[model samples]
Target: MSTPQNLKLPIPDVLASAICAANRLIQRLAQPWLVQLVLRLAIAVPFWKSGILKWHGFLQLSDTAIDLFTQEFQLHLPGGPYPFPAPAVVAFLSACGEVTFPVLLVLGFGTRFAAAGLILMTCIIELTVPDGWPIHLTWVAMALAIAAWGPGRVSIDYLLGDRNARW
Candidate 1:
């Protein structure tokens, strides 16, 4: 039997060069600024959509949003699934956070703060719907990544010379 090291087949010169070229192309396309921008947009969209749905007009929480918080959502914690305290207040705050944080994220203004807000929101969402952990975990991961990295160069933070400052 051939050992693992001896079992490898050699790549053809043309194939090796093609792979290198592809890697170089990918590196060029996936710049840090572009990756950061995409991350900001990707994470912002869902929150923004949810936020807009919650509002009937400026500062107005829709009946559906209020009703959902009061009737449907709960904190699935130890010993009991607790109803959200002050559901109206919670719903209004949630709506505001969902709206405001996404705009900050997309603009890359207060990007880390926005990401941290999203992280907090994700944690609350996880408590509310334990079954949605898969998606919630993804949101947390994106938010944490943004928080750790800060917004990249294509951002208001960068333009204002505040990019390096921890928000």
Candidate 2:
């Protein structure tokens, strides 16, 4: 393809030198650990706190729980069930998942799948339960980052050579 005369370069060396400099700059800026750290902190704090509350027997804070817990806020799921089941253990498991997933995410361990699970749960809370928009947003963003970037050099996934491996 012929270059447009107006766009033609007078000196290809200038372009080549610029390109090389840009490449070096990119490598210097490629701090995967920093990116992962941001992902861990921004995503995990709320999750860990919320999950810890539930783990401490707070029960599911879903629509049913909201209505029951605070009369000030009327709540309904329309077709939703409570966060907890009759067995109690199911709720416990959910709590543990929420609690532990954040820890794993913070540590960048199996980040993608962990983030994916948490993201699914958050989407359920946001879409089905309708009370966790911000939290869901946090999870969705971080989960996506984890899935997109994999864990960083600071992560167990990286140390174990699973950074590029998918769940």
Candidate 3:
């Protein structure tokens, strides 16, 4: 058999192959675990900050916190001229929710449940603060993404085999 000639690829073909390889490399670099970790952190930060602010005075109620719940976040009932007042209770519950759920999310324990709670919290905030829908929608989208995609393999839930627990 005659010796085979060395085959040479065209310059454009080589460039195209390089580009394709780079595209695949980028896609591989965007690992699901890393993405989930980012999502968890991104969505958790705001809630954690809000929670920390609200719970600054753990045992005692701060006047500023009270004022926000009473004045800014009051729920008006149609029944009476006076409202069904539970500002302190609502504020405490909300603060607890924000803190607890975000911690769970960041830890990747019960991520889906945490995301759902955040979604509910977002809904309440939207209803109460309609003007802030844009911000709330962003929060909702992040939470929804977590809820939909789950915590991935980097999570405690994955270790515990609960990563698929979207409820």
Q: Write the per-residue lDDT of candidate 2 for residues 22-118, one digit (tens) a residue.
A: 9999888766777777877788887777667653245544543333333422224566444433324444555677788888887878777888888
Clash count, predicted structure 3: 0
lDDT of 1 by residue, 59-106 (tens): 999999999999999999898799999999999999999999999999
Top candidate (TM-score): 1
Cα miss at 1, model 3 (Å)?
38
Candidate 1 Cα errors over 4 Å, as ranges: 1-11, 165-167
Candidate 3 per-residue lDDT, tens place, 42-123, comes to 9899999888887556566567777888776644335523322698887787888889998999899999999999999998
Largest lDDT belongs to which candidate? 1
Pick by TM-score: 1 or 2, better one: 1
Residue 103 CA displacement from its true place in model 3, Å: 0.5
Candidate 1 clashing pairs? none
Model 3 spans with C-alpha error above 4 angstroms: 1-22, 74-84, 163-167
Ranking by TM-score: 1, 3, 2
Q: How many angstroms is residue 70 displaced in model 3 relative to the true structure, after the best TM-score fit?
A: 0.5
